[model samples]
Target chain A: MEIFLQQIINGLVQGSVYALVALGYTMVYGILGLINFAHGEVVMMGAMISLSALTALIGIGLSPLLALPLSLMLAMAGCMALGYGIERIAYRPLRHAPRLAPLITAIGVSIVLQNLAMMIWGRDYHSFPQLFANRAHQIFGAIISDIQLIIVIAALCIMAGLMLLVHRTRLGRAMRAIAENQHAAQLMGVDVNRVISITFMIGSALAAVAGLMVSANYGLAHYYMGFLLGLKAFTAAVLGGIGNLRGAMLGGLLLGLIESLGAGYIGDITGGFMGSQYQDVFAFLVLIAVLVFRPAGLLGERLAERA
Target chain B: MSLRFVGSLLFATLLLAACGKSATDHASNLLTVRIGAAAPLTGPQAHLGKDNENGTRMAIEDANAKGIVIGGKKVHFELVSEDDQADPKTATIVAQKLVDDNVSGVIGHLNSGTTIPAAKIYSDNGIPQISPSATAVAYTHQGFKTAFRVMANDAQQGQALGMYAVKNLGAKKIAVIDDRTAYGQGLADEFIKAATAAGAQIVAHEYTSDKSVDFTAVLTAVKAKQPELLFYGGMDAQGGPMARQIKALALNVKFMMGDGGRTPEFIKLAGDSAQGVYASLPGVPLEKMPGGKDFSRRYEAKFNQPIQLYAPYCYDAVNVMIAAMQKADSADPAKYLPALANISHDGITAKIQFDDKGDLKGGAVTLYQVQQEQWQALETVGAQ
Candidate 1:
């Protein structure tokens, strides 16, 4: 029972990161009807940028506590600019072309971003500085580290904040309008391009925060860190229904919980034939099963009525 | 087809022939023995690769300084270094390039994944290849007479670590985790065998990928088993994080790993959590070995950097190859390989000799513990 509770905590923490990254994928797909494959790269750049900023600020004799938020903001800002630039330079040009063009371009952009990060940071794993005090509180004989608690709380706060932004604000209305009917939204005097860019900015910032939280939680960062995380998040988005906002969150958390629990129990359940080493196989299998069973996704509506 | 074009082409061919003849004659006047050193000079493992390359470079420089006269003419040793990027495919390409460059012998292809594949290329061309760091047991079992390594293989180190954990650490129940790489999986398999043989109950066995950053779920499961010790088979990058996680999870058990996790990098990554972790390093520590002090001083003076893991072994590998050449009285690989098979020397690592399977004859595994943020040697265990 303690083991199960421990897995639940681990799953929730892991799920939060997946949920944050999933928002980026879902938002872009919502507005542009394009799966921004480079969204993962945005997450990587967010971590890398923030790490460099934190390192620089700490090197200049600033306290790590003071440097933490400043580095995070810098990373968020950098990722926003990068997201806006990428959409403008790569996706915007191909918006009217065949859907395949923008999809392929997104992949190309992802590769370019990865290689660029590798060139800047070198292809080595770097230890991320722990910004918070390292401590764990036991809950029902299960341990919850301070970092995990902070990450889960921060993720929930961000999700709530995003929900309010998308549902209550004028920008939210414009975004919803565009997702509903781009031509009609433009006809209704919505600055369609501006709203799309704003959506990307918010999504990119969320990804950046997710990146920071993951790096802080794991205490390691590298160029390829975002690949698998991004892949799993994309799966999460699809499982919840791509282009659906709330569904992404649901999918992310569910995927994380499933992954953690599966990893924890598979060895015992399978009598040691399959273990934590095959943990990733379970996630991929979930993805395939979801795709096969429900092509439209659990929460995804049809193309015309997507919101 | 024009007369001028034909004349120009003929003149160019004559000039090329003349240049080739002069170059060959210049080479004949001063015999140049090329030694190829292939390593991942541009990847995550670049620091270690550079360390290997520097060791090989220092050996070549020392050999040249000694002015050994091979085949009557004064021998000038040239090192042909190539970057394998730690990729097995890139390693083979680098091996082919080194062979095309006509090197007398090769000194690396650092990782086991790279070395095993590159060994076939070197053996196909009858070139002797010595690995300074690759410790996988399968490397020497391929029947490639040319493949040689200076350090103990995973079988030796893993067995030593297992026995030490059970006997010395009093680990009655052991849980194992591996990163599922060729090196990690192979080492873990060896450890399981030895630990079980040593009468330790195997309670839990879990695995993770090399790129994994989290181990909480696995640890929670292992925690339930209430194992006395946790043995990991993987490199420092993953091991360090796993150590951090283990500490975070408050799993009251000792940690043990093989040579891959026995570097300073592991200590740095694990921070305060690295305390009391036991790791096995192949061969004796640098300060305790025969030529270790002289090699360290010279290497520091020459390279302006401390010798990372595997430098001393690399230095000895180059010297051992050179010793074989000297004994054979020829720089030709075919001649020296026979000498290499039987040649014994007191190298910086130990008595350098290969068994029939091209494995180190008396390879030793040194156990270490993290104390005060540094790896301190506990004891040197002889291969069983």
Candidate 2:
């Protein structure tokens, strides 16, 4: 049905964003074995920084065509720095302490970043400027906006680029070495700490891209926009296998499609008692189901089991 | 040592100054009357709260310029503003703090969820509380003598909106969406009741939370139902984005909402997609009201920001309370209570008079349409 197609498109767009953010979660977990909860805050900062950068450039009489890409680069650079700094200041210090210590520190960092953002931006829903003219192309009665198409393509390209970066380079080998065995990787002359920082940088950059695209797609941004998104991405990471890169992408898209279809059909399936407000429940339900059925996730985690 | 002697002398001087200032403060306190203005001044709704505060502040300034004598004293009205953060728990806390501060009256707690709970606290303390923006019917139905509002309740505005959709807009099949807040759900329920009464079929009823960002799945479902008009019951923050999303999904239908969507901010948020949207504001358009133009001009000149919404009503609420105190010839709540109960005055919004239930008597609902991305008032209904 056209309705199903429409839901699929929506799902794909939403899933791409989740997939991009999930890569951040999965990569950090793969390399550092820490969840990096504050990655969501970094995602929010990406949107905020890009918005301000775009505004500043446009205010100085630059054309939006030139300003848009330039602003995005600024966002990427800013998020990379923030990602590196947060890992250095918050996670790195707690690395050798208990795992619980780093986990709690990630949460603490999330709170601090959220408060800082709130103070800087004030608590308001700002309307993000549309980067491109939005027009919908009808495919068999299913509407796909230009922004949605852009997001899907951008997400795919980024994922492909990340795949190459993880599989075809010396850095990729070093990253895999560290994930496989940190002690052996260090013995093999791989700088484990630097590799870990690079992983954080790569993950943060992906989140920044996701944040910018999602904000543009939604046409709005706020201080708390990233919290639910981060949670959903984390669920996606866990669903696909926390330490697996391709699994994060697969899990993100699957979760997105399921949520969209479920939200569209749940009311009819439940006989009109429930509605789209219950859509969030589907994501959690899938999470719990995955955790029970496949404790190691769909694609098994690649990290070695510690004694 | 010399340093210790100088520190003791400074402490003694400060003690003497404190004692002297206390005596002067006690006298000044008798000459000043504080009116508590509680609203969310720091959160997303800060603009609305600041508008409410500015309206109250402007009224107090005007009263002082007039130099009204109350209880044989030329009272200088001071506004004690508190931020409720639009939370019910915070509302009650601020209400208690205001009561403890011994304010002569209270102006606002913006949302209905906050106003209703805070009203009970004000009523318990025998203080008059007037809400400028809260429109839920349950706010006044609680039988709290202290609770009053300057705007029409949800019942009147929602009925007017629903009837307009059926009668004027010719909406046959309508869909309803609510943000599931006290205000949003209450208005949606009232609109559904009236819309069904007016013979409009509600094809779909969807609910979303206040914090939700995406409405694609919900819109896709509603689009299949093929409604002629889509009515949203929520604040502008949600309504504006919903409008944009509706357009993004290419759901072709007339969009409509209650006063929550009838603001300049809504148009700004929705951008070009806001065109053709219908909304009902719970008062006559500002240009048509007796004192609205003057108040708006003064407000814009003073605040440097256009009145977001409800500032006129807030100005009137403050004036109405002051009017009661003037008629009672006393600033004490106990003395002014009877005067407030029977008081009537022509305010910026309307002839301010309350029915026995403390509801605004015959409050008007004005329907507006976004024409060329601007809110153009179309008709005024149900004034009497």
Candidate 3:
């Protein structure tokens, strides 16, 4: 019982990070109809930028608490600009070409971003000074840090804000219209290019927040940290139904829970038999099982009019 | 027309003879000694590989500056590096490539899993190979006469930590966890055996993957057991997060880990949670050990970064190899192998001497603790 509750809490905290990153993947797939493989690198860049900001402020004798939000905002802004720039340079040229063209371009952009990060930050792990240095509050026999709670709450708040924006704002309406039918939305006087750029900006910003939270929780950041996390988030987005906003969130949470529980129970059996090295293989096995059963994802809607 | 063609052929033959003679003379003037460095230069373990490479490179540079002589002929040493990518299969391929390249000697394949497979290839080819950091006991137990190591093996590290926990910390009961790699599992098993032999109760045992971040489930079980100490045998990627999670759970149990989790990166990853954690490393820290100050000054002068855990061992391996070459007075590996086996040279880490199994003779393990973000040397235990 206590073990079960504790695993659930752990899963939820991990799920929040996945959900935040998955939202970015789903949103870009929603608007652009292309998998932004470089989305993970964008998250990495945000973390690096935020880490640099925090390190610099600390070096100059400023309190980390005051520098935290400022660095996060700067990181988000930088990521937004990078997202827009990559879309314009790499994706825009191939917009009229075959669908595979943009996908290849995204991969190229991911490599470029990774190499750039390696050059900027050397090939070493950078430790971020602790953000929630000495703070924790347990609940219901499960230990929870303030940072973990912050991450969960922030993810929910972001999802709610995104929902309200999509359903209420003019830009949100334009985005929805574009998603439904790009040609028709253009004919209806919706600036397709502007909406696409704005979609990328919002998604990139969300990834920045996720990156910050992950680095803060783990207390370490590196050039390659985003690759695996991004991969897991992509799996989540597909599991929840790519291009489905709510489904991405659900998938992220579900994947996290499944992984935590799998590690807890299945890990013991394998550890006792073979050793614990096989614990990582459990997550991919779950992913394969989920995709086999639900190709369109758990919450994905059936296409009313299949193209 | 026939006379003109014969005249042209004669002229071309004369030109070829002139060029061939010049090329032959140039080859005879310089003797090239090729040494291969097989390491994980590009992967998750690249950071450790790069440190080892730096030490190896510095040794080669010093040798070249002094000029190596073999059989009364001056020779230049050439280092050829291949990236194994920290995979055993890739390591075999790289080893075969080095063998094909006909390198006189080889240095590396940092991980034991990779080194074990690669060593077979080197042995089959009659190439002498020395590893600076592969500490698994199986690496030496393979009975390869050509294989040698500069650091103490896992058995030594395990017993050192186990003894420390019992004698110094007075731990009555201890829990253990391993990341399940061959290196991790082997060390954990040795530690458990030693602790149990020393009359400590084995309360709980768990395992985690190298990629796992949340350790709440395992920590909760361990906390329920209420062990006096927790032993983790894994690298920093998993160990750091485990420490943080344990602290978050408020377990308050003293944490001890092996050399794999003793890097500065661990402290960075665990933050405040890393404080007061004890670890068993293979040797004393560079600053505190005798004869290390000069090595430190020289290493810092050459490489800007601080020397990492295995850098001194790597330096010693290179020194021992060079010393053997000088004694043999030949670049032929068959001649140098016997000389290398009988080495007795002082190094930055310690005196270099290998037993019949190619394991270091009289090697020691030192205990360290994280004190205010730095590794402070706690105690040293002689070779088991």
Candidate 4:
């Protein structure tokens, strides 16, 4: 029972990250009606930028406390600009073309970004200093770190902020209108291009936050770190019906829980023969099972048929 | 006019003969020995490959400066480098290319996964190939007479780590984790067996893929087992993160790893969490070993980068190859192959001698602890 509770807590912490990244995927998919394959690289870029900021600041004798938030903000700003640039250069030109064209372009952009990152950082892992080290609180036999709590709360805050921005703000209405009917929204003077770009910026910023938190949790960042996380977040987006914001969050948490429990209980029964090495496969199996049973995901919604 | 042209041609022929005789004198004065280095210069393991390359390059330069002699001929060694990208398939192709280039001997294919496949290619071609850092036990077990390794195999290092955990650290219960790769699994198996044999209870055995960043679930379960120590047989990329997560959970259990986690990169990745972690590397810190300081000084001067893990072994591999070639007195692979079998030489890593299976006989292992963000050598255990 303690093991079960422990696994649940572990899953929730991991799930929060997935949820944050997945929200970005679902949001961009909703507004743009295109899968931003480069979203993963955007996350990687954010981590790298934040790492650079932290390293430079620390090298100049600044405390981590002062560097942490500053670096995160810089990362977010840089990623937002990159997101805007990618959408304009890669996707905008093909907005009127066949959907497959933009998809391929997005893939091209992902490759370009990955190679650029490799060239810039080299194929070596870089360590990010722990923003919150040696700090954990025990709750009923399960130990939780301060970073984990921060990750969970930060994810929630980002989710709430995104929800408010998408529902309460004028720009959010414009984005929703564009997603519902592009031609109608354009006729209603929504400035479809501007709204879509804003959507990309918003999604990219959220992914940056996720990247920073993940690097903080792991205490290391690599160019390929974003690949697995991106896949998991994409799975979460699909598991919660792509383009459904709340569904993405739910899917992320659920996926994390399922993976944790699967590796914990089932693995123990097998004498740990079914270890966490297969955790990735287990997560995908859950996705396949969910998709097979419910085509529209947990919170079935018909937000955007194209995506 | 035709008679004058014939006369000019005769005079040119006489001048060419005189020049050819002088060129022959210069050619006889210089003997060039070509050695090949095959490694990943443009892939995921590029950092390691580049380090090995720098060591080999420095060795070649040093040998040339000394004017190495073979059979009374002044021989200058030149390195022919090829990038294998750390892929087995690519390594095989690079091996064939080196053979085609007719190199006297070959130096690398750093990873065992690549080295194993490339070894057969080298053996089939009758080329003597020595790997500096490939430590998979099965690498030397392939019965290839041409395959040789400078470092001890994973089983040896794993046993050393297990013994240290049980005897030195006084850990009664231990949990083991591997990254599910050949190197990782092989070492984990050895560690687990030895740890169990040493009266340590096997609490929980967990495996995670190299691609995984989060090990909370696995760590959480291991925590439940209440182990005194956690042993991870994996590279720094995974081990560093695992260390941080373990510390974050405040488990208070000691963490131990093999040579794979003994890099400065690991300390950087694990931050303060790496403070108390222990790892069993193959040799003492370069500054402590005999001739190590000289090697370090020369290596830094030549490469402009600090000597990384396995750089000394790589330098020694090149030196041993050159020594064997000097003894053989021929650049032909067929002649050099037999000569390398019994060759013994003192190198930066150790006194290098290979058994029939191409395994280094009785290598040394060093235990290191991460203290104040640096790998400080704790103790050395000679091979048993």
Q: What shift in Å separates residue A148 of candidate 4 from its native position after superposition?
A: 1.3
Please identify which of the two predictions, 3 or 4, would achieve the higher lDDT against the true structure. 4
In angstroms, how far off is B356's CA in candidate 1? 1.8
TM-score of each: 0.89, 0.89, 0.90, 0.88
* DockQ for the candidates, in order: 0.52, 0.55, 0.44, 0.54
Error (Å) of candidate 4 at residue B234 is 0.7
Global Cα RMSD, each model: 4.3, 4.8, 5.0, 5.6
TM-score of chain B as predicted in candidate 1: 0.90
lDDT of 3 by residue, A1-307 (tens): 6666777887899889999999999888877678999998899999999999988887888887788888999999999999999989998888889999999999899989987987888767787776555587767767788888999999999998998887788988888888888899899999999988888889899989998998888777878777888888998888888888898899899888877676566645565563323445766776777778987777764332101
Against the true structure, candidate 3 reaches a TM-score of 0.90
Give the clash count for each candidate. 0, 0, 0, 0
lDDT of 4 by residue, A208-305 (tens): 88889888788777777777888888888899888888998999999999888777666767765666677777888888888899987878767643
Question: Model 1: how large is the Cα RMSD against the reference?
Answer: 4.3
Off by over 4 Å in 1: A96-108, A180-189, A301-307, B1-104, B294-307, B322-335
Q: What i-RMS does every model get? A: 2.2, 2.0, 2.5, 2.1
Across B181-267, the per-residue lDDT of candidate 2 in tens digits comes to: 789999999999999999999999987776667778788889989999999999887788889999998898999999988888888
What stretches of model 2 exceed 4 Å from their correct place? A96-112, A122-124, A177-193, A241-243, A295-300, A304-307, B1-24, B27-34, B42-46, B57-82, B89-104, B329-334
DockQ winner: 2
Higher-ranked by DockQ: 2 or 3: 2
Deviation of model 4 at B213, angstroms: 2.2
lDDT of 1 by residue, B241-318 (tens): 889999898899999998888877787678778999999999988788988898899899998877767878888888
| Residue B314 CA displacement from its true place in model 3, Å | 1.0
